[model samples]
Target: MRYVHLYFTCIKRSMISRLEYKKDTVVALFSFFFSNLCSLAAVYFILQAIPALAGYTLAEVGFFYGFSMLPISLDHLFSDEFWLVAYRRVKDGDMDMHFLRPVPVIFQIFAETFQPEGFGEMILGVALIAVCAGQLTVSLTVGALVVLCVGAVFGAVIITSLKVAIAALAFIFKRSGPLLQIIYNFSNYAKYPLAIYPFFIRTLLIFVLPFGLFISLPVDTLLTGAHDPWLLSLAIIGAAAVFFALALWIWTRCERRYESTGS
Candidate 1:
């Protein structure tokens, strides 16, 4: 409870810092909105040409894309600071301040940024899901809805755990941005139906990076009844717990190796 309060207090401070530059915040909001808009437009244009992707209809594809954004946007909202840590902070000794805090360094990093830009993605994603869901014929089940909710919330935890684990590598290597970028780019593949990909790529997305596990699988269950929703929800929750625990372990181990650049 104390940690929860501290987390919100830190988030409030971060929000105040960002809100001080109101114009910049607005610009950031629009930039993320339009960026997502452009991506959706591209998907629309491609569907116009191909009509369907891997037996998935246009509305179904849009639903997949929209649902995919939920986990990514949530991760972007809460863990944007990890990007800086992965790319530059450890190398530049910017992490020294975090280490000096009485709290855990990982907690400090998590609280360092509260990106309002992600709200743009969240709004657009929810709007797209609503619009596309209305066009689809599939009936959503109670179990399916529960799985989707679990996928969205716990999926964010999975992505954030991956980021935390990757960023911790910087403590040892001094920069893990390129590797993190490469791994994160895999999430883009999850934006479409996994059936569109080859067997190996599909396996990698589900078992290795596991982006498709949470994003594509839940949507597939809803649209095609591909998996047992109750089991899938359990799998997602278990995966999230395992990934988060492993990430914390990795971060704690790697953190001990950090040495200031003394720059």
Candidate 2:
């Protein structure tokens, strides 16, 4: 427990150090916030003219955008390393130091480059949530809040694991960024309500890819009482398990591909 706290403390300190050293940190952070706001604004403006996106209300669409973004933003903040894991580790051979570390290579990578600028997006998400709370009427029950928290954490884990698994494949293939980017693009579909999608489309998002569960569907359930909360929780746990196993398997298989210069 102490180590866990220290780990996060280190991450916070690292972020503070970077912000202090880089004069443009604040600018970068605000830029991120405005960029996200711009995206949300475009959605809001489009929805203002249109009655509904499929079956989702304007407020619900707002909630969906905010909620879906929460997971991706958090993932970007922490797992940014995964996106560069292959390119940096392999091409530059910088992974040598990681193998010498006491902690896991992945943890070390994540800890080394913790970007808190993502906090800006997170704050925007919170503000969006507040707006959605006001716009969309729902019973703010203790049970529902607990469910949402669980779902969010699970969503983060699943997204992280998906990234890890995909990045781990870079061990076998040097240039994996384009492939990862494509996967990220596909995951963006969850930024809106999946309910309006056809049966096959919904099934593909919910089961095959599972990004739809991250925000749209779960938050939709919270807003409209459309689906079982327990199902979201279960899906998060299940997806995390499956993806984690796959990542571990790939990492182990590719460990042999690792060649350190220190030897």
Candidate 3:
């Protein structure tokens, strides 16, 4: 409970600090929002011409695009600073400050450097979910809805785990920004039904990268029922566990080898 209070405190401080640069923050927010809106437009135009891509209808594809955004947006809102601060601070030798803090360095990084721009993606994500939920053919029960919501929470953690794991590579490489982005962009596959892609791409998305686990598979479980829930659920657990454990191990190794600017 004490740690929870500290976590909230970290977020509070970050928000207050961000509010000091209100204009810049708002601009960033709208810029990201507009960017995401353009993506939705692109999808709309594609479906307008073809009527259906693979077997999914317009509403089904839109639901996949929108519903999946919720968890990714949530991660961007909170845990994105892991990449922002980890890379920059390490390169600039500013990581020394974190060692002096009483809390864990990873926790400090995530909590301190908040990015409010993610609200752009987050707002549209929720709106998309609403628009598609009304049109979905599935008769999702209250219990099923709750299950999918839980899946969203897991999806956010999975995304963060991947980000932190990749970003942690910065501790050794000193410039993991591009590498991290390369892995992050793999989630672009989540925008459509996995069946539309080639077999290799689907395999990578499901097991190796597991971007398929983000929102699509969980939403599919909610809609179609989890005949093979383990296909996605276990893969998510396995992916997050592997990546997060690797990040922590690497972080520990790097911390032990750290040579501060003054030391």
Candidate 4:
């Protein structure tokens, strides 16, 4: 419970701090919301002409799009600061303060820089998930529902772990702004069905990039009907756990090696 308490306290303070810059906050929110609109609208228009992609209806495709994005949106809400860390904090020596804090370094980093504008993605993603889910042919069974709820958490963890590993790279290189953007932009593939891609791309999404775990696998189970569908959820949870350990190991190693710029 102490962790929960710490999270709420940090987030509350961060929210208040951000609210002081109302114009920047409001403008960023609007910009991100419109960006999401453009992506969704692009997919909408494409599906209208193609009729179906990889054997799924527009509704199923929508579910895939939003389900994949939902966890990512949540990750951005909490860990957007990791981008700042990658871009400037380590290089400028601001991360020195994070090490001095009593809280876990990661928790302190995330809690100190909450960006509420990230919720624009969450809002649209959830609305799309809800409306598209209703149009799915398979109803949500109790077990499937539990898998999705649990899997969503693992999904968020996977994204956070990816950023953590990437940002931790800043500890070594001091700055790699473009690398972070490259990795993040690769997630655009997750917005579509992984199966629609070629074999090599499919492998990357499932194993290397693993964005398919966030959306396609679970939705595939729902569409195709699995006797032991929970296994897929277990796989996601297990993969996330493994990746998290790896990310933390990288962060710890780099933390030891970090040399503050002292500027």
Best by lDDT: 1
In model 3, the runs with Cα more than 4 Å from the true position are: 116-120, 141-147, 222-226, 229-235, 261-263
Q: Model 2, residue 18: what's the lDDT?
A: 80
Q: What tens-digit string does per-residue lDDT give for candidate 3 at 1-263? A: 88788888888888898889889877887778778878889989989999578777888888888877777887887787767644576677778888898888878877776566666677787788888888877886665565466556777777787787766777776767788888888877777777678888888887777778656677667666753555555656666678678767776676655556564
Candidate 1, residue 51: Cα displacement in angstroms equals 2.3
lDDT values of the candidates? 0.92, 0.74, 0.74, 0.81
Please give, for residues 1-263, the per-residue lDDT of candidate 4 as tens digits.
Answer: 99888888988888888889889977887888888889989989999999698888999889888877777877887888899889998888887777887877877877777666657777787899899988876877776776667667888898889899999999889996679888878777877766778999888887887877666777766766643567777888888998899999988888777888766
Off by over 4 Å in 4: 1-4
Candidate 1 minimal-lDDT segment of 10 residues: 115-124
What C-alpha lDDT, on a 0 to 100 scale, does residue 144 get in candidate 3?
Answer: 57
Give candidate 1 regions above 4 Å deviation.
Answer: none
Q: Compute the lDDT for candidate 1.
A: 0.92
lDDT of 3 at 196: 75
The better candidate by TM-score, 2 or 3, is: 3
Better of 1 and 3 by TM-score: 1
* Per-model TM-score on C-alpha atoms: 0.96, 0.86, 0.88, 0.91
On residues 1-263, what C-alpha lDDT tens digit does candidate 1 reach at each position? 98999999999999998889999887887787788889889999999999588888899999999999999999999999999999999988888888887999999998889887777788888999999999999998998899999999999999999999999999999999999999998888898988888999999998889999999999999999999999999999999999999999999999999998887
Instruction: Give me the candidate number with maximum TM-score.
Output: 1
Residue 122 lDDT in model 4?
77
For residue 123, model 3's alpha carbon misses the true position, in angstroms, by 3.6
TM-score of 2: 0.86
